[model samples]
Target: MNEPEAGAAPEEASTGAASAPSGLSRRGLLGLAIGGGVAGLAVGAGAGLTGGVAIGRARAAEDAHSAYEFFGAHQAGITTPVQDHLHFASFDMMPRTDREDLISLLQDWSYAASRMVQGLEVSATGAVGGPAEAPPDDTGEALGLPAAGLTLTFGFGPGLFENEDGDRYGIAAQRPAGLERLPAFLGDDLDPQTSHGDLCIQACADDPQVAVHAIRNLSRIAFGRARLRWSQLGFGKTSRTTAAQATPRNLFGFKDGTANILADDTEALADHVWVSSNDEPAWLAGGSYLVARKIAMLIETWDRVRLSEQDNIIGRDKGEGAPLSGGDEFTAPVFDSTAIDANSHVSLAHPDQNDGIRILRRGYNYVDGNNALGRLDAGLFFLSYQRDPAQFISLQRRLSTDLMNEYIRHVGSGIWAVPAGAEPGSFVGEALFA
Candidate 1:
């Protein structure tokens, strides 16, 4: 995707500027229009309009852009409407950094993240305003972009509390009992390079570029304090968060998250998503646990299987995504029905079969081109949030018996303690330090 040249002017510019090139991207043109000064809008000679007026107009135009608030009781991305694109990255704190370094990093991240979520630059001296001798404060690719409903959710991995160095941050005593490296599962062919980290950020937006831009700039902001461990780009969201969103399909083409916990279900969220005040770690009261699994699908092999067999494995019809027990997508499955296999994916994952356990899923499909074997390296990057990590552990343990396991391999995995949203002047995870 090529960006518009900075010097070009949009067709709508009334400054009598020449038209932009035919190839000017829609995003580039919008940027020029919204930026106010980008297209060289010369104020009339007789009118004594100050540059501040121009900047104010630009700020007002920014109000029309789509955005989400960064400060709240809970992070925006977790239960916020699932976006179409994702740029999820994990990071490790730099060696020898102290608690002050960690605190400063969080503060800096929150400040920049707050601005970016509003369609503003990461800093007051953003993309082009910094001293010419210094690098730009922002990467500038999203210069003309709207927020595109961008959301950045941060989390702490077990390592952030205690690692080989042992209680490096002095917050080890506050670590949630359930916040640890997940145990090895039945079919996990785990890759060490992609799993685990001291910190993680889940960036999501409607536009792929917007999502990428958030992570890229934040990674830059972490220059000395932290380093990115691994990242994944995903599209075609595999789950829905609200009732209005239609169920989405995974790489297997089966509608996923049909029975997922919705954002508006307060009781369900309280019981299964948000951490209660009485929970062991008081600091994580309103937060949740995030579990990420990179499941690789054997596309060629699955495609070769008969349609009926595929449906049987999933316990739902591939076409309508209705249970084989004869109901619509949302109908409760009759697990005992002869048509539904007890070991089927749906049956094994349903709450009825697992003591009413549920997780809010916000996942996406990813295609990382091809593997060395010439086979497509494509699969589902599974993301789920729960009040307790044990919820996921037990569910996953039950899934070991899933018939669909034959076609999928869990290649990468991670778990993080997603802190509650930052207050107006505080950074995320401030409660722990306080």
Candidate 2:
């Protein structure tokens, strides 16, 4: 299908008479029209348009094109308010039996999912090297055997996953960041301890409904071929502000992702995220990177501490993600300064101990307990995509010794090698170990 143009401005819903609905609110009716039209498009595409071939094909093409545009617009809209951040983790797998069967199932699932979500699409790319090294870029030219197994991932954007009342979680808008950042993020983090198996799929659809539907459908389709592992974390105000400004922030409430390298343009993506090589294989170039982390939140213990004390430990205002030393989200943290008479960088504070370790953190905050507890039960599920994982590990280890360690835990973790997109009929990992 069609891919959304990266960074396109969102389209304003028309306010004129032709664009208005008959009886319902314009926005409500528009939501129904888009959702219903997408469902019908998927069903028609899957059945091969036997009943209304011409109509089905036309509608499908039109919807596919519009979906991408919708995604761009949706991203722009949500980025403004910085509502919520959804963090996702996925692992690659090796098929135990019947490679061809596995491929068939995966393809079927991909097609089905593409139809389910607005602006959803799938493509194959080259795989990364072992856990410790960077991925090669000669993805298109090198032809390898089909992957033994594949596991895909999808994450939602802010506010789009909510219901009509904005209270419950539901799929509403499209937030396609697939083309924007996921490939490189996957490749740089793949490794043996973290690597799940053979093939990996990383996806970011326009909205939560699309992401949830796509992943579940894909999982059902690949049930026999591979096992799926998944988790999601939601972001509060802190992480969202950092992301909207294209910077990274951490759970400890520090301006964490400040040093990240930007990939604002396609050319920059090739230089920063994708891999290219002549010595290895011609087809492996243009492949990107992957990185994964399973971070545990230390909610139970953190709750014991007073709010002011907790804020002091994290180095930022609990509400706005601003530094305790004082500044807005994107402003440079006064690492050497202090808000209170007490030192800002305490001897064992998270930011103080880890002086130089930096990674691009895209995390989600979650609340799991009941309201009776008299407090919000939440912590960050952290995910960082980088050209390497070593720096990330070092940063965590440093935090492990700091005071924050008492409140946080590293419960689950894994890494995977993500491949770049390839031409049609070419499955992921068709280059390295064919």
Best by lDDT: 1
lDDT of 2 by residue, 1-434 (tens): 00001111112322121111112222222222232212111121122113222332233332322332111112111112222323243423323434354444444433432323232222222223323253321122112211101113322222222223442322222221231222222113233343233333343322223333444334434444444444443433233222235433444444443333332333433333344454223333434334444444555566678878877765556666566667774445555555632333232333334553333333444444433665433454444443333444544443433445555544344443333332333333334324
Worst 10 residues of 1 by lDDT: 1-10
Q: Which ranges of candidate 2 are over 4 A from the true structure?
A: 1-95, 98-206, 230-289, 336-358, 368-378, 424-427
Candidate 1: tens digits of C-alpha lDDT, residues 280-351: 799999899999998999999999999999999999999998999998987778887799999898888888
Per-candidate Cα lDDT values, in order, are 0.77, 0.34
Error of 1 at 326 (Å): 0.6
Clash counts for all predictions: 1, 42
What is candidate 1's TM-score against the reference?
0.85
